[model samples]
Target: MDNSNGMAKELAGFLIKHYTEQLHSIILSPDPRLHYPLLVDFAELLDDNPTLAHLLFSHPAEYLLVFDEAAIWAQKVIFKDLKQWDNASVKDYVHVRINVSGSPLECPETFPSIGRVRVKHRGILLTLKGTVIRSGAIKMIEGEKIYECRNCKHRFKVYPEVETRNVIPKPTICPSQSSKFCESTRFNLIEDNKICHDYQEIKIQENAQVLGVGAIPRSIPVILKDDLVDTVKAGDDVIVTGVLTAKWSPDVKDVRCDLDPVLVANYVRRMNEVKSGIDIPDDVIMKFKQFWLDFKNAPLKGRNAILRGICPQVFGLFTVKLAVALTLIGGVQHVDASGTKVRGESHLLLVGDPGTGKSQFLKFAAKLSNRSVITTGLGSTSAGLTVTAVKDGGEWMLEAGALVLADGGLCCIDEFDSMRGHDRATIHEAMEQQTISVAKAGLVTTLSTRTSVFGATNPKGQYDPDESLSVNTTLSGPLLSRFDIVLVLLDKKNPEWDAVVSSHILAEGEKENDNCNEDLKSTWPFPMLRRYIHFVKRNFRPVLSKEAENVISRYFQLQRRSATQNAARTTVRMLESLIRLAQAHARLMFRNEVTRLDAITAILCIESSMTTSAIVDSVGNALHSNFAENPDEEYAKQEMLILQKLCIIDEFPDLKSNLQ
Candidate 1:
């Protein structure tokens, strides 16, 4: 193990060589148990590739290797080995369980996949495993014991439920019709002297066995590093094998080893890379442009991305992958996830309502991005998301936030509306200007927060036809106007259309669906979009043509006419958004000059939103003008008498006022 022995270098080289050979081949095996050893080997191999090691591991201290499949398997195996796998001790065991509640309805034949189990610990940490378990599930288990299976609506007795409920169920063994409990339910183990082994105890159904306990695989251990830990110890990814543990409070479970980290890391890193130079055929682009043009004119509300296959491409646009793809082409290494590394044109923002596939899309895009996608909800404050002072090396060093973690990539934000006003406001300049100005702890520094942001928010309580959207009703106007494309979601509504829509949604699930090709044709495919983005990026220098400039000017002038004299500048923001979008369009064409087509396309999009806003403004103004005048009783009476004389008063005064 001595440095002079060259053992570490040899080990690293061997790993790199073996992994390099496997790189071009497919691992085919979906099992994580088979993959962990390769991940470990890959990490060990990277030791010789310092650049790769630094990219893979942020810190080199102690690492606590954990596997989800192993933890699950260990619990199951341990329980099976026990005299009473279904006893109070087993019931009190902690682990992750699938949530089969709401999922069963949408997927009747298959159980819905509820996410992971997380242990409550305080520290910074990195994890590479399967998807995360839901937070609500953890909270629910910590507070309760026995729970009903939301999927089957079956109630089972366990340790935590035993303490709070009147009875404890006895364990039974059966292969089919297994007894189940809520995945999040947790409990405590206790003994009663008053009751003997069989004194009035509830028993599990005859021939019924526990659910999913015998199904998990064995665990694999990897190195856990201490220096890599964060203040908020996040979750880890692992494989588990054995008897499944009963859910318990503070849901922290230990996983035993089988596979190593070598395989897993390799697969993850490969899958996480930003794919580039995706050459889509011209016919595909032409079809995409056609559908997009059609969809633009008749764009519906609430699901524009779903009008076709555009969601995937749109999703990619917000991902840090876009930045990484750009960076890789530029030949940069020793990369950091902090958003500060990139320049102004790289940042992106997506603002929309629920069910727009914003969250789902963001998650997918983040994983694909080269830069890490750090996420936080609106409830998260500015200090928590950006730069903060932390004690490092015995002195305070500025710690990076989500933006920092996503520097060369993207920052996907959900529930943007739920963020505090101040926190939300702080991001305005960062979004437009692409730089974060931090002034705290006697340190005033401007970090390059050139991170693309994919943000989603719900519309105000109701969609109003006519009203100036209050900042509370949605994001502030300034923020809303900042996106390169304010693509509205407006799917057509029809009671009879539900069956057709559901059919398409379900068909999208099946590989053999007839409409799949049609669906793919309606939008720009991901490959094409990536190529388009790449093309624009390659030709960065843009010029405004006289014709295009005239068109842009004409659109701005028209928009100004629509605005009040005092609000002339208001339209400028929209103009800026149009220009940026036009630039992207020009980039897609690989042209240095903005063409009339680009300008026209930008104007069309702007006009669509402007038209809707105009309707809202007109109706709102009329409504306010008619009713806002008569607040006092005397004034109200006078107005009512005058209205009556003018034949405008009606039984439903509110409606009458609104109409007026």
Candidate 2:
């Protein structure tokens, strides 16, 4: 470490030996894709030399420079020895970039949360993970330049200071060989001799689920240079490995200037999948398998057992819980012949009044997701719901809103009815197309919002069965149609329901909960439930079977043929929702093929949300629906009755078909 030239030489040798094949392809191949700041796995370096790798943690800047020089040196040697050179400009492209992964850093204990980083951690190498909330403009900066002293005519190479870039310190005295008397401080800058790299700035915030309850998620600004610029955008979940450093704040009138902590990223890696960080062990998978095996004949019962864990504090909302599970375990996304992507992520709306546990479900659903964002509708603007363009340091930066930040996971919006009509309308594209298109402040781009939206709203005045959802919730019909399932949780004053709820509450209070755990002795705990949801979502991508397709098709055809004002709502979107919800149920049942059961469950879920249908109107309230002793028998009877009713409606068109 003390001998800089020797260390550079040693690292060059390491690169030449370990990365010969990758280098050969990059340099010698016919592909025009230029590789800049060549990537080297830190884990590989650690395996090759523990001492040097460990030194990299403490003295990153010093060794990073060495690595960059070594990379360029190795490339020159490669071209000269291999005689593969045509243009001399090709050798200037190689620079070193170390990607940090597979280390103690990845372990939960050492994983650096942005909020937990302290002053003592500065200058030490660490990998911080978060979702990119704001990405600044990419601009070039001066790297190194040659200067000529005006008085002594002495030439010297100068590099920008690491702590204060864009600054080239002047030498007090010129060292113009044999002219020791020339004490000139003046220097002429050689603009053409400077080396500049692409530079960018991005801000990332900690994941709310990872920070636990009641903890405020903190955001940090990251500095990206060269090839790292433009590699990440707003809404990306990335792991940045870099040395923690402090940058001097700009002077402001009547304000104190202090150093602001910033992360100078060495390597930035995006987590393509949101829940990729979660590690579900083999034992837990086996436990889930055993639970299903124990109730193989009663699979719906096993599924209900898992459902009971979701918002357990709230009593008896079977339909709501089932919809929550299906929304979390979304259907499979597919691309059509036109290359337009159909989103599989389903959106749910919980319309309830006065302490029906709508907010509790929102909070609990946030916990179930690995990545989630919780915000109230009262003050949420269109900017926060999607993407916001803000002026930061005189430049327009795109800051990701809740939907964008919660990409690939879930976004829970409470008090949905309280939001402004314009704000609610902004999320229509995000809910259905799963993307947010931004054209503001001269910045135009599209950001993916592939997240299921779980919103809780209250209906206007008393709940009305005859009124459309648009009138009841004050949301437009077009906006309401975007939601795959909308469950109304009206708190009706029912004596029998109230009596049972009170008794259940009393029994729950009496039962001692010191030994309460997941499987207390049957229900899954939060961790197990979270693991199962994450596992099923990643592992299962169910396709529609012949029977499922037929069942779904018949229901859609029925909805279209029915003479009702709600017919406008039953466009191709309703059919798409049917397919998505069916696929989700198949995943919930741990199957790759959607069956008739999945199709019916999907229909029932959709029926629970429908205002008026062409078959049955008394499907019962979703709030009072509870787990039946034989749910299979119940759903079977319901399905057959639906088929028989459809036949009857076909025979007589005056039935005014309404499947409640």
Candidate 3:
């Protein structure tokens, strides 16, 4: 006991010598009664006293108490007058939050993943990263309650045990004396003497992108105390530093008494950034620049190289791959003068036959984004796609659905045609407005759904050249318009194409990739490709050049003159889609200026998406298109004819902006 006291005194001296400034500020705060934990960097401690730091990680419960005592004593020593801030003398000080820097001692290689946390990690400090799937209602829990015995009128304090959380156990006999002498089991608890603190339970699930194929995502319960409670909610990505502890499961008849692991959070930080909290290094950014510099002259060909990495096994769907890249690396989001928000994310829809590889693209797109949610639309409801109110522990809590959870990322829906009409209608607001408004169970709030939708659906029966998309898919015009690029992938009978697909499939690994022979040399692997995507999204935000704007205006006028069957083609939404695609294309080429070539490419994308006869005659099937030898020359000739037509419309300035 004397040795332990000396050790604690040594730790106290260390604290006073190291964190004197931090302790002084916290102690001299306006309200000393409030708990303001002094953040102690563990790395600094490791440098100062390696032995003490190692002991702190091993026996956290005992050492944390000592650290708390040291912090209080250090504050009093530094300030000299601790009672000036508080009316009475302080008995207990706030906790010392140890910031675990660098890699933890979980695996000795890297920080432990959520699924890697096991029995060996219990009672020790570790860090975890996960998404908050659900959170319980905040409630006051008793930390310490005072009890008075009836026999001798003796006072004692009872703390809630881990197994029986929030429920203090009653004493069978008087704690003041032995049961044989007292012969009393009665005890009275004083409500006024109870010490309560805010508490909540949050369920965190591992990242889906990190999980293996067909493996079920694992989740763990986290306990938040005091100031940590209610700091985060569903759909948030959080990093928690805590101690792993175990609690007994519910006691039921014929049920085994098992212990479940739960984390008691020491510190919780929320990362609400759009990048999914990925930290990219400066050297990697230099690599990206060097990757582009290799193909300085032919930028379009260079972009195709990156697109080749998208679903590499699938053959000859250059257009689909290009659209996927543009959708993932979307345009800049800005607010207009009227305070209306313009979304930058691009939505894509693939309407194809059974063998057209639509589902392949959907899966690949989901895997491409760091933060994504993939779900089938079969039997899906508005509550499932948006937000739903769930009752947990007799309290109402708002649970995030597919779109809500995929905020600032992608939400891919397979079998989109299988969803009900009412269910499909619920996502119209989420797709365009980028938010889900919930007013249920006496909770009224809005959750962000700033995600791009990648949906794949089949057309009813056979392809109809004369019918509109709404009649073919049974989707409303408003809903259909939400998608910026609606590519129709009809598996038309062509013997040459069939022979090519047959030879490719049979050859397997020996299949020839004719579309990207030279460009595929610079194709990146999956990890590097994903990092490149995140890099562009985090760094680049492109703005339109005047030439790009003019090209977009010309295409909008041409579409309005064509009198499209699709309602999406006729609205101002189409114009917004054009600008977004152009900006995205510019970013894909690693340029800040949305070039004229970018505008021309976006126009060609829109032209191919439509089913008009004029487009089919001029632009070939998108699935069969390849990287042109000289795209600039081809685009120049095409824009010349469009410019000739624009000259006629130039006569009437009033007719502009009235594309409807």
Candidate 4:
């Protein structure tokens, strides 16, 4: 004990001297909670005296409590010692707080996994990483209290010990020895200025990928005090360093019940806006290079193979698959010199028949993306898709929804037309502005929603070749215009196509029976493709060549001039869409310059989409460049001719009356 006390005094003197020099200017700053680092090497301290190091690391609060007077004396001595050297002046009595953050190598007690935390781990320091799912309100905690005796009129202070119990300790009897203390209610309590800490509680759940499919993710509650409070929010991935402690039930009868484990955090590190932390190996890079080389040699075959690899089970929707692939690869997002952001991510919509594998494609896309959320329109709401203000611990807390949570990634909404009109309208700003603004419960803030939207829906009416495509789908023009590529899938009664599809399905079934797994596997594995996409998105930025630019401009002008009211006219957005698609095509081949071929391909895709969805005349001829402005003009002309014939018949009836 004597040796430990001597060493503690020596450490206190060193810290006081260091603080006196380091904080001479900032000692009188407004923020009194400013703490100085001791900067002592724990390894050196251990080598010199193991007991002192053990006490300092293991029982820091106890060591500070034991040598409080010695530390104060050291502080005063340093104050006088600094005055003689540098003429520094400050308050004669000021409490000096110290902090120590030792090297990770020296902290062997730091446990990595929260799953391995057990009863034996209590009171020990640990490190854990998880996603914050919930948080409570911040409150003030009293660290010390003063009580006055009612009968004897005597006052005394009590420093509360660190314990899990919620109840405050009271004096057993008055200092004057007047009478035995009956209850804590009989004494008048006093607040101590130096004994308070700001506190908040948050719940963190394990990463979803770490737990396999169908396994329930576990969560643990954590407590943050003082500077650590309000450091993290929901949907943030964080690494926390803290001490494990047990929180017992308030009721004494429930003593045998299981105690809740809570971590008192000392440090927190947030990991946000980082998508796909997968480290691509050198072999994977080599494979990607080889694949690119082959793709450059045969662009059409390579693109088709990549599209097939995206979702192999969906049969005979080549165009839809190609659009989805382009959306996944995306274009280069740019922020100009004037701070106007042009979005790179493309939006896609699929309106098809019931059994056409629309939902299947959506699920596959959601699973393939690194940070994605898949939700059905019927099960979602405006607040659920954007943000919500919930009351937690009697305080308003802003909770992020699917779009906000999927920031910088993909969001797949199935059954798109099933959503309420108001609920669906909430996504308009998110789609265009790439942001969601909330002004509820006196909290107004805008959150980033930089995510690509991929939606799927079923046709509202029966599929008839004679009917207009807009009449068959419930989506409005405004909503339809948001999607860069809108693909229409029909279950046409083609005998040859049906037979081929059936044979493919049967082949897949037979492969399953024969245990032939090669057919079911993707050419590029999902993880490898995800890593490659992330790498390209981070490293490559494609620029449009002059030839490609001219082609796109000419196509946009021609399409605008040729468009009639019935046919959807090309707009500025369509021009942007064409550029985005061309860039995406260039990126697919790992090329930095968009070629004329890429622009031609984009125009082809646009023409195919328009031809499939536009109105056709009764003679089964699609109104391409000569599309009529009014679809009802021919009917109106026929009605007028019939009226004139009836007038002529009425005139003939007068002449026929004489013959009868």
Candidate 5:
């Protein structure tokens, strides 16, 4: 084996030992039929560790990480293994005869027919391991062994003989169907001249082993010699397995999952020698592996994918989605897309304590691609995430803020709660509507800011024990509802948890300082993230369905009817949000169909946010209004002042006369 292979083997062995030692202690479960001790090596293989070659060779495809699909396969394998091990003993006789499907079979050359097997154990027959039951196989006949009782001279099948001395062999005292057997002789002859012995069933299990080299894992796509563009069809499952390249679009201005066919083909061809399974070159694998590790270790790829797909020009300033610590604190490792891909809507929020890395993720995302923009909720002009007025070559130029810049990518907003309340009012228009129209500077310029926003904020006072419900916090209901996901972060004291956090932090720290400021020079890992983000945006686009359209329309109509003001604007904004969210969900699912479910889900998310905002605002507004304008309270205060004057008058009557 080459150096890479040697390394893979060593890594795989280490992982196997590590997993086996920790399996019982951990909650890790294994299937009786399939080996789970092999998973550690499987993960190592994906890591492309050369030491995992032995495990890979035996069950290469089985352990290949296919994400969601792999989990399902593992579950099934575990169930099958457990079943086989539950009933392992009872193979005492080399050629034991058993009745199956109305036919007698010994050593079971073929499986008992499906119908027969179902009938044997009340429609749930248990078969031994390696039992092959053909469709036409028959059940065995009963009463093969029988004997005549010597005492009664009556023929009967002896299943469990009682006393051997009192009973005769062969023609007397049948041993085939009796519950008792004779005790006189060790072996008793039944009517059919067959000898019978008492035997009990025992369960047996064997360690799962590979009979031969397993199939190549689906996750590891082999580089085919053929050009995918020339040979692959639209629906064909072609794995290009090529290195990513930089490709930008002015229209999207963000890093989306798009690939330049030319770039892809070029990269694929340059990876190694074509048309050979000899082995992936160490140099080539190492370069890609490093890239993969870097991408995985950082949030660059995930954020870039979102940014590139949404906006590209102002991708700078927005942070990437690399807040692993924040995610853990929120009790979420991975969140399901909010029904957008299938039905069409989703909302996500990022809430955290100070220094929880939320700001970093947003800023990284903004700067990673040309498509994203960054904004904050500090004291600023109201409406539109970022709108500025300036002279434009002899005319007033209406400049758009981070939201507009992130038209197609992502809008990374920091200090979201710190934004002015009036300015917050303006976002209600752009967030849902996808466009920011400025009716100022004597110019009616509407900038298209159809972006996915990843907003970060800290809670007021302290983190609450119950965060799911809305309370008096800096984050308003209107804004919170816009997000399909609500993630929160808090500090931890657990060592194990801290180790995981440290691993991520160390990985990120060691990376090149891509984003450096005077005091804090930290790398955001945007360049690498941009590549992955662009890849996803390019390849993932789901179409909206008519059914989805109907659902959204009805939802909008309802929202409009319920809204106190700007009903049409709110409806339209929510509509756009639903569409974008649906598209994102579809991309995540790797599907092209934007079903009705996706639209409904999108509607639900939008409505939830809108309703919550309306409630909170109404309550606050009612309180302010009632307290601000109360005629009765004012009269009461005047009356109290008059009474105090009268009481003072009596005591100071003479003093008042002198003053007069």
Candidate 6:
């Protein structure tokens, strides 16, 4: 014990001398951006005292207490040695921190899966990688408190202890006299000498790629203090270095019973911004390159194969599948000099009859995307879909919704027409501007919602052969116009088509049974396709060629000229959609330039949507009618016609009796 005390004092003196010599260089350095709490390498400290270094690596919490005491001792030494030269400024602002690096003694454990972490690992220093799901507000916590006794006018300091029943400890007796303290002898908190530190809490969930299908994601709470607070936001992937600690209930008699584990983070590193390629095997890469070469050599057959690989179980709807494929592989997002952003994501809407495989396709898309969320219109409200501010511990805390949570990925919404009007209106801004503005309950902020929306809905009325699509759907014109592609699937009465569909369904069922007996095989599995999409989005940025530009421009001009009155034929949004689709098509071919063929494919997709929605007739003529304009006109006309026939029958009494 005597040797330990002497070693601590010697280490304190050494640190003071080291800081004093480095102070001038730190302040005079050319680099203006220097991190506060200056980092001290552990290797240098180990050279001075090997025993202290060993203690620090083996038991960090105890070492942290010793280091903090040494820091205070060093401060006093500096103040006394430099009394004549701005001593107050150095005492107030200069902070030194120790970061253990290049030390073989302290080898951090491998990051554990969130679901696999156990209570036995508490108090151990470990590293973990996850995605931030929620973040709490930054707050100030009392590190040390000072109290002055009224009886003796003496001051004492106490370090705030965590997981203790008594938060504020009382001094045993008056310092001047060893007597029992009475009620009149009170202690008042001294504000000027108190030490406070910034603190925050965040919840991180396990990464999606590591979990199997249907597995529930698990999360852990991490407590960040001092310089580490507010370093990351929700949806960011981060690597956290921290010591796991347990929190006990204040009312519990036994401190060790039912302790809830939490982590106290020392450092956080954002991982998403760093470019780490997906872990694809070398053989897989070679096969992927050969597949692309085939696509480049034969464009038509390659495109068909790609579409088939997207969702093999669902038969037919080839155009709809192509649209979904393009949506998965998004285009390049661009921002102008003025900071205005143009979204590259393409939105799709599918409206069809029952048993049309709408929900199945949506599920398949959600599974293939790297980051995605699925919700039903009836199950989610406006606040639940966007952003909600809830009161937590007497302060407003912002919680991200599905759109905000899937910012850089996909959002799949089913039964879209069943949602309330108010609820549906909330997504209008998010759909176009790619942002959600919240001004509820004194908290006002705008959050990014850069997500591609893929929705499916059923028609309102029964399937009618002669009626237009606008009459059967419940969506408004403004909402319909936001989708880049809208495909309407009708059940046609064709025996030949029915026979083919039946045969395909039966073949799929047999194949599934056969796969149970043999090893399962898929041409393009979900994992490989997901990695391919991520690679394309990360590495490829396609530019439009002159020929492609001419083709798109001519198509837009032709559509605008042919539009009739009150017809929802084309707008500037259509031109932007065409460009996005063409770029996505170029990415599908693994090319850096949008070719004329890509432009033609984009035009064909747009034309197909327009035809299915009845925006234009068979011969390329505009249909000047919609659900939003004079919605009740058809009902009123039918009622008037029935009343006129009733009047005619009333005038002819003999005819009325004959009918009866």
RMSD of each: 22.9, 4.6, 5.1, 13.6, 29.1, 13.8
Q: Across residues 1-660, which tens digit of lDDT does each residue of candidate 3 receive?
A: 455667777877888888877766676666645666777777788888999988988878678767777776666566665565554333354778877755245343225778888888888777888888888878888787788887778777776766655587887776554445664688888788656778898988888777888877788889998778888988898888888888887676797978888888887878776356477778988988997898797776678778878987677777888899999999899999999899999999888888889988888888889778888888467887898888754578877888988998899998898898888878999999998888999989888899999999989889797998877777778887778888888888778878877765655544266644433554678887888888787778888887778878876877787765755555788889989999889888898889777887887777777767323345677666655566546665665545455554353344343322
Candidate 2: clashing pairs of residues: 518-525, 613-657, 613-658, 613-659, 614-657, 614-658, 615-658, 616-658, 616-659
Please provide, for model 5 over 181-272, each residue's C-alpha lDDT reduced to its tens digit, 9 standing for 90 to 100: 44322233344455432211111111012112353211111111111212321111111211112222222435464421111111111111
Candidate 1, residues 466-529, lDDT tens digits: the string is: 6543432466667765554433343335454446555657777687776676656645455555
* Best first by lDDT, ranked: 2, 3, 6, 4, 1, 5
The superposed Cα distance between candidate 3 and the true structure at residue 565, in angstroms, equals 0.9
Can you write out model 6's per-residue Cα lDDT over 291-336, one digit (the tens) per residue? 8786664565555656656666775566777788888887788986
Q: Is candidate 2 or candidate 6 better by lDDT?
A: 2
TM-score quality measure for candidate 5: 0.33
The candidate maximizing lDDT is 2
Angstrom error of the Cα, residue 578, model 1: value is: 2.0
Candidate whose TM-score is highest: 2
lDDT by residue (1-660, candidate 2, tens digit) is 348778877887889989876666556645443446678988888888888888887788778878877876777667666664654333455667777776655764335699988887787777889888899988877777787889867787776654563465666666665536676778887777657777888998887766676888998889998778899888788899887887766666787877778888888888865455589889988987887789899888878888888888777899999999999988889999999999988999989887888888888998888878889997689998898989876689889999988888889999888888788889988888888888999999999998999998989998888887777888787877888898887777899999988876666665565433332455668998899988888898898887778778888888888837575367788888989999999888878899878988888898888877566853778888887777767775687677665553343233224433
Off by over 4 Å in 4: 1-129, 134-203, 206-221, 226-231, 243-262, 273-275, 464-471, 511-522, 562-570, 611-660
Q: What is the number of backbone collisions in each predicted candidate, taken in the order shown?
A: 81, 9, 0, 0, 135, 0
TM-score of each: 0.44, 0.88, 0.86, 0.69, 0.33, 0.72
Instruction: Report lDDT per candidate.
Output: 0.39, 0.80, 0.78, 0.65, 0.38, 0.68
lDDT by residue (1-660, candidate 4, tens digit) is 465567658766655644455445433334445322222344555655576657655655455444444444555555554655444444322332322234442243454556656777666545677777666778887756788878666776666443544345776766553356434335777654456767788878776556667876677888876667787876677777666777664444535655678776656767674445557788987887888687665566665556656667655466666677778778888886999898888888877777777888888888777777788898789887888888743578676777877777789999998899899888988987798888989877788888899998887877564544456666666666667887667676667767866777877767565433664553566676677776666667899998678767766776676665324325677888888888888887677899766776666556545633222221221111121234234333432332233233233344345335
Compared with the true structure, the alpha-carbon lDDT of candidate 3 equals 0.78
Which candidate model has the greater lDDT, 1 or 2? 2
lDDT of 3 at 91: 32
Candidate achieving higher TM-score, 2 or 4: 2
